[model samples]
Target: MKFSVFTASTPEWSPEQAVAELAAQGWDGIEWRVVDQPASPDGRPGFWAGNLATVPLTGLEEEVPRLRALTEAAGLDVSGVGGYAPCKQHDDVERLLAATRALGASQVRIVVPALGHVAWGGRLPTGGDYPELFAQARDDFRWVADRAAEHGVKALVELHHTTLTSSASAAMRLLDGLDPEHVGVIHDLGNLQVEGFEDHLAAFQLLGPYLAHVHVKNGAWFRDEVQGDDPLATVGWHHEWTPVNQGMHSVVEYLRTLKGHGYDGWVTLEDFSTELPLAERTAFNLAYMRRAWEEAQ
Candidate 1:
């Protein structure tokens, strides 16, 4: 299992700083966060806004070469491109794929629509029409597969919480007829703990050859409040990101399971917690993961 860092989690570092630090800290690759994020109100970098490590999508074509050169200079490979382009948007997907191919990266993330009551940018999720959303995602992915083949880049759908494809089986449903060579799935264990907790052995076995990549992180459930009255009343439960070693699921066992299954792919760290300083947290995750890998052996 090769180790990498998704720049989405390293919001404070610039692209150049990220490459140099990651290389010095012994990371194998970097997954560039490809998004056109809004500027922060106070002019400081945040995870989703004003992120310095991100590769802006507006002029990504012209920027790919410079990013590629930087990663190469730091002795890091481009593990993948982490984009927020929805799978249904062909133009956006194509734009990302073109840049990914030029950067010599094999895959780009094409997100599926949300499902639960959660919202994005103040817009409600598609909570009413499950069948419709699934059908549309399937159609969209078919087009994505065709376009990916043309570009020699594989399109990936991440199994995220509150999305149409959160679980392994659900992702498989959308990707049933599509060829794994052109399109694949990202097995994000952190997201699974929030919405789709599946047995590691079963989930991996189910994904089979379609599991092209993995995102390593950890999360746990928390109780925020308890509504009044009845014995079985609704309890406000939420999931929060935690340190890799302190989450509900065991990171060590997860890595062991992946190795046992012969998954020789990238395991990108995506810790979203804000407990430690940027550099310390980044280095800590790598060291923790390295120890886990060694202990498993």
Candidate 2:
């Protein structure tokens, strides 16, 4: 399996710094975070806001040459473009794919609209009508698949919390008539802890040909204040991102199961834990993954 680092996890690095350091660290590729970010309030980089490593959506096509040259010069591949394009928006999806193709990347991430009461990673209002949203996403993805084929790129739907296609089964339901070569799924292990937890081996077996990429991170469910002492009390649970060795998801077992399925694809690191400094976390995660990958082999 090839290893890449998703730029969203490297908020402190500039694009130049990101490629240079990733190459020096022996990473095979870099998955750019594609989005237009607001400037940091305190002039400091952050994960979700004002991330310096992110590639802006504005003038994306024009920016492609610079991006491609940087990665190529650093002896790194553009594994993928982690864009936040909403699938329902044609212009957004087109803009992303055009840039992805120009950058010599084959895959780009697209968001599946939420189907119901949303809890995470979405700005959609609560109480969305499920059936209506499902039909909309299905129609949107069909259009995306066709466009992706035209651009010679694959559109990937990520298994994210609160989204319509948060699990492999749900992703397949939406992706069902779409060609797997043009449209595929990103299996995100950490997000599964927040919503869509499934047996790794079984999920891999189910994904089969549609498993185009993987996102590795770790998270655990934590309880809010206790409401009552009843055995069946409704306690609130929240997700906290953790390091690879510190969370509920097992990186070694996940890689073992993935390898067992004969998947030799890009495994992008997206560690969101803040337990250590940015550079330390990046190096440590890479070393840990190397050890885990060898163990899996």
Candidate 3:
């Protein structure tokens, strides 16, 4: 599989700088944010606990060509569009698809709404019971898939926390009902580790055929039981996000599995540590992932 970097971890750099750095680190491509401009110039949205949001749609018609030229100049591909679009919203889906087409991205990453309850106090609702959510998501995504197909794009549902597809089995169930040509799965190694290394591997095996993209991240389980008014809030408190080679997850095994399955896709680095400068940390993680990729090869 090829390697890429997501600009989410390095928001301070312009897209051009990010692409250049990633290419220098041996990345084949980049996943870029496609939301409207952030409320602040610094790129962090005040909402969502200081997390970055998608790039704004205004001027994207002009911006897309600019970004495409930038990546092409750097010998990198625009891997995909990374943005938050609640599939339930038709308008949001349309906007995202428009951005996807403009940016010349063949795929778009979307999140499933958060679901389930954590024993430590983090509780989320099961999306299965919320038929309307999936119904809306499916219908909207189908429409998106149709439009994307017209432009040679595919819409990928990310197997991330808080969505119906948080786990492998759950994610497969969702994919089984969709057309692989138009829709596929973005398998994340770190999210799979939430269930345990072996369990995550099992999930990967189960969904390997549908993996359209991959996220490489590492983390370790913490034994501390979080004490808080919200048990769900404590769920993340029990684990530590770490750089790719430093965590308990068997990244080597994961990459080996992908290679064994004849998976030739983008494996994007997504470690989210705030301890180091963003650009420096991205370079370090990219280097580490390259070593792992070489070893796996």
Candidate 4:
């Protein structure tokens, strides 16, 4: 078993500093977030202060190797590579597959769209043809899996809200006939904490064979009172990421559940909140997880 932090949590750090600090904080690996823009620009190290501007999808050929060396030198492993690219986008998926090899990462994460989830961007299905969307997504991801096989890296479909993979079973169906050797899934419970909660045990059991890694994060939803009166209000969800253990879900129990299920894979941290100071949050999350994992053992 191992622990890793998404570099999206350390945007302000130079690549060297990001790896150094994470290693020092006792993390075992890096889950690199490849993005087109900084989610937060005025970043003091926080979740929004993502480690962006590192590699343009067009330029991963050389940058990935250089970044890999920097991470390994700091005593870290490349747990996985994550990006916002859609599976239908062949070019983006190809660069990520190459980058996964260059960084020595065993897996790459692709966020499959969830229906009715606005945060997943335009690829989301708010309302329209249902079966058509599922069919399209399945075909596109199958192609992605086939392409990733050429590079010897597994492409994971992240369980996210507002996408075809809003639940584990739904995700399984999408990847039903594909080779698990090239494609898999991520149990991102945090994303589900909002509008897509799935039964943990059932989800894990079904996806266990194809599970590449599990994402650990926390979030909760609140009502938009301004829409109307308390009882009659149009309740729009106000979801936000929070530090582990303090959110809606019992994260400690979640970790214990994964351990109990015989999953000895990667436990990736993604505290997507930008509230606490960098070291404090990083240190706290690391310490919290260590304790939970120890207790789980």
Which window of ten consecutive residues has the lowest lDDT sum in model 4? 44-53
In model 4, where do residues sit more than 4 Å from their true spots?
38-54, 114-119, 122-128, 223-237
Global Cα lDDT for candidate 4: 0.78
Residues 153-233 of candidate 4 have per-residue lDDT tens digits of 899988877677777888899998888999999888798886557778777888868877899988776765575456765
Please count the clashing residue pairs in each candidate, in the order shown: 0, 0, 14, 9
Question: What is the alpha-carbon lDDT of model 1 when measured against the actual structure?
Answer: 0.90
TM-score of each candidate structure, all chains considered together: 0.95, 0.94, 0.80, 0.89
C-alpha lDDT (0 to 100) for residue 79 of candidate 2:
90
Scored by Cα lDDT, where does model 3 land?
A: 0.68
Best by TM-score: 1
Model 2 off-target regions past 4 Å?
A: 119-122, 226-235
- Cα error, residue 197 of model 4, in Å, equals 1.4
lDDT per residue as tens, model 3, 240-279: 7887777887788788777767787888877676667776
> Which scores better on TM-score, 1 or 4?
1
Between candidates 3 and 4, the one scoring higher on TM-score is 4
Question: Per-residue lDDT tens digits of candidate 2, residues 1-297?
Answer: 789999999999999999999898899999999988778888888898889999999888888999999999999999999999889879999999888899999999998887577654436564668788888899999999999999999999999877888789999898988999999999999989888878888888887888999999998889888766788878888889998889987899999989888999999999999999888888888899999999996
